[model samples]
Target: MLVTHERLAELGILYLEGTSVESIDRAAHAVILSGGTRLGYERLLLATGARPRIMNKTVEPKSRITTLRTYADAVAIRSTLGPQCKVLVIGGGFIGLEVAASAVTKGASVTVLEAGPRLLMRAVPALMADLIRAKHERSGVRIVTGANVKCIDVNESCSAVFLEDGRKHFANIVLVGIGAVPNVELAQAAGLATDNGIMLDETLATSDPDIFAAGDCCSFPHRLYGERIRLEAWRNAREQGAAAAANMLGAERPYIKVPWFWSDQYDETLQIAGLFREQDALIPRVLGPRGQLLFCLAADGRLVAAAGFGSLGAIAKEVRFAEGMIAQGFAPKPEALANPSISLKLLSSQHRSSL
Candidate 1:
């Protein structure tokens, strides 16, 4: 849904595409910012997302080393690929794998090199990572984990990558999906305090109370985790935007929701419905040959989060009852979770409404 042009238009938010903010000045009742053009607002929100981090010391901003952050980036890569093309993807994270899968489906020879030991190592457990890697490998996508890209060699008509192990991989095109750095220069220039991301309170108000920031650019208080986190997920961004707007209108509601993220690669669709630390114990179960579910239960047995990679209905069911499951440490018996009644739509409506 993220890359879908239809969903992009459905959001209906004012999107100033391909523009970089030049400056921002925030006052009590009004704000002014420059993005190739000047924009004035009574109450301003900085929803500027992040940009992909380029690691190649040699690759310039405008080069064959492309980073996927917008529809244009995807379009550029799609238009450039042809049958029997070789693609070298740097960073085996979600973005990298998704791009590789897309290219492989279009008849490209894809290879993903991850600096870590496993794909999505930081986002999921080792076993889950193995499952994702296996799934991709079955689709003819070669995965090289624990491999680092030392430099990118771009010449007149071709590009190649040099790995730390002195191995070279030639590619018709190169895609760097290392990760993202928040677009907070405007907020920083306006004197807003920022650490990993823009620092904000429970009300989504920055250090400068006159200005509020949301989406991927802001970090705010999280009640469940008992700390502030910078979340870059779509659901978090949309909810935070609405919360910031409400607080600006004197509602003062704290932005408190379990951060959720989802990814679709080839035939596998993965959904994560809550937040859990690295140390959280995951209770895994296989519902069928095609459906798998993981419940992250706390030390006390409360369900902290649910991750699944087969059935959206099943995943949504568990997500809806997430609070009760978390608070009470409840885990459905093996047989109950297998039942058809555990649907995502029903559970989401029943459980999520209380929030």
Candidate 2:
């Protein structure tokens, strides 16, 4: 619903609906379609995105067992949720937790199985993970951490998720949201360089000069972090597409936007800006009873990242200010960051003045 064929046509774009590109002829600067149609292009951009990681080969496709990746998958999952539904979610990451919350909101009995030691162990700090876990538990969601799933046995009406330690949880619906893998097969088959994803330089150009890539399928070096990172968020994908288009038109600009991510579960919202390392110094800013912010400072005291968990109204503004500080490379004193009385907006102003 965001864009229509008419809109694209008005923009002088040729919309090829429901046609798959079979292969790329780099030397001819053309692509072969599914029906053996050859389409030539001066410049090409691959926004192939990603696919949900499957649990294992032993898990066969069933009506009751599913993975959420596309709109259709979400619709299918929603149709199966109700008061009588018993939902079991595999993985405790963002997608799993969000789906669990939605299922619980629909009066479904929900249980989450996470292989990690704690929920969100790779995404956020242990303290933040604990807070999120507590909130979910309070909302009637059963969470099992350090859970090693052996296999899923599906029957006629329900599925049983078996664990390594001789335990099984039966549910009417089983949702898998472990993670995602970039769609790099096409890029690789075309003789393009790929590592984790399609490798791109700072300008989002692929190995072939006439071709480029953006979104989840591309991995570009981040100037702020001094390393290559691929983001699967919607905002990043949208911005990267625009940037890639500009670069294709000879703009010659480097995409250096700071990374920002957010998730909504029940009445709580979690926001993170920039990348945080385990060894980074964490400064806590307590915001009364319902909100808290954690600032991650690098070894040299630079504000590298920030995370906040609470109501949207309580934490959104503060996270915005912190994001600005991180983008500006501000290094406020640890004491100033810890004290809620010292406004982050004021600190941001001071940082701008110093620059």
Candidate 3:
């Protein structure tokens, strides 16, 4: 899955090697490159992406205390990790949890800490978060939430994590997964409007009409949601990039793809479709030879999101149907959705028709 420079070169793309944009001169409608190259474009698309959110601004990461964001990070973790290794992971989000699970698999004793009250508090519904947290604990992953890390004492031999509540944890390796920061320095330097990210219109164009942005670096108005949202996922980035390209070419295409994301921990495949809130009504459907399928419905009765934990094939099959229901604002009957016997595909189709 990830597209490489060689792959793009094969696809008739001119890959500019070692070219860096220093600044953008909007008056001249050109980008100033570091190598004294001025590249002019009719329409510019800034897909800068994002960077990993480190533990602290004051503390610098060394061998023992670091983060897992790149291939090199994985290598470092693997090299240092072994049986009976005590690993301390900060943040109960997806990255931290995933890393903890992987460490546990490699026979490392793992402990994860989250500042928030619950795991994936912003991403998934409360019930789902609880279920997933319980599952992880059962699989030998120690999790702690509402933990305020005051300081970190790092030395060559070991690193100690100090909390404000007078708790200290010493570990062999520390992996931080607080979150990510949008790489918007270039956009900011170019004088484009930015808040949490580069602000984009429904067409994914930025404040400057000639320039556009997408992926994790830009926040665009959501068609289904009435607010501006930025999604950092492989599917979202890929789809938004294509949409931006089409819009830049004078083909008026609005990005209306329902938010979809997935993660794998151990043998289970967790997949989610559409954006779900904690207040959404969760309807669990027990299925055949698979785990439960949880559907999240908004207050207005529209099916907004669904999460599946079981067979990857079953989750993959349900993704499209779930997306359609959310995009169409289809409100499936609670009776139909809660029933275990009714096929999810059929339910979605019927609910969509009812709308």
Q: In model 2, which runs have C-alpha deviations exceeding 4 angstroms?
A: 62-64
Q: List, residue by residue over 1-355, the lDDT tens digit for candidate 1.
A: 3455666678775665556667775653444335345667666778888888878454543377878988888898899777768888988888998998899999999999899988886566666677778889999999998888878887656687888899988887888888888888888988889977888999998897767889888788777667778877788888888889999888988877777878888877777766757766776767676657776765654567777776565454555555445543454443344454465345444445555
On a 0 to 1 TM-score scale, where does candidate 3 land against the true structure?
0.93
Who is ahead in lDDT, 1 or 2? 2
- Across 78-111, the per-residue lDDT of candidate 3 in tens digits comes to 8887787889998898888889888988999999
Q: Which of the numbered candidates is closest to the native, going by highest lDDT?
A: 2
lDDT of 1 at 12: 71
lDDT tens readout by residue for model 2, 7-122: 99899988888999999999999999999999999999998999988877336654446789888898988998999999999999999999999999999999999999999876
- Superposition error at 137 for model 2 (Å): 0.5
Candidate 1: stretches off by over 4 Å: 1-21, 27-30, 33-42, 59-62, 311-355
lDDT of 1 at 306: 72
- RMSD from true fold, candidate 3: 2.1
lDDT of 1 at 219: 80
TM-score (C-alpha, index-matched) for candidate 1: 0.84
- lDDT for model 1 comes to 0.75
